[model samples]
Target: MSKICEICGRKPHAGNQISHSAKKSTRWWHPNIQKVRVKLPDGRVKRMKICTRCLKAGKVQKAVS
Candidate 1:
């Protein structure tokens, strides 16, 4: 699965992890991506990978039963 947010274009970011001994290691911070069915402008429901922030912010309408 692609780890990218379709709406916000969010993806994994590079960072570092520090240990108790102050040793740093490379790490990747992934966004909270979810597979959801979105209601498009033309009233079409399509599945997409969206981030939690976009979902919470109502950036796209969700397809509800």
Candidate 2:
């Protein structure tokens, strides 16, 4: 499964990792994605990949049993 936010359409971020010896290596900073049960507009609960930021911002409503 891909680490992408379904609500915000966020993807992984590419960057370089530097060591103490000044050596650079390629690395990716992935977003905090989680599979949450979301409540749709029709009151149906479905699992989706969502990011923490969007969850905190109330972009999607979580289904609570």
| TM-score, per-candidate, Cα-based | 0.94, 0.89
The C-alpha stretches of model 1 lying farther than 4 A from their native spots are none
Residues 3-42 of candidate 1: C-alpha lDDT, one tens digit per residue: 9999989999998899999999999999999999999999
Root-mean-square deviation of candidate 1: 0.8
lDDT of 2 by residue, 1-65 (tens): 89999988999989999999999999999999999999999999999999999999999999998
The TM-score measured for candidate 2 stands at 0.89
| Model 2 misplacement above 4 A | none
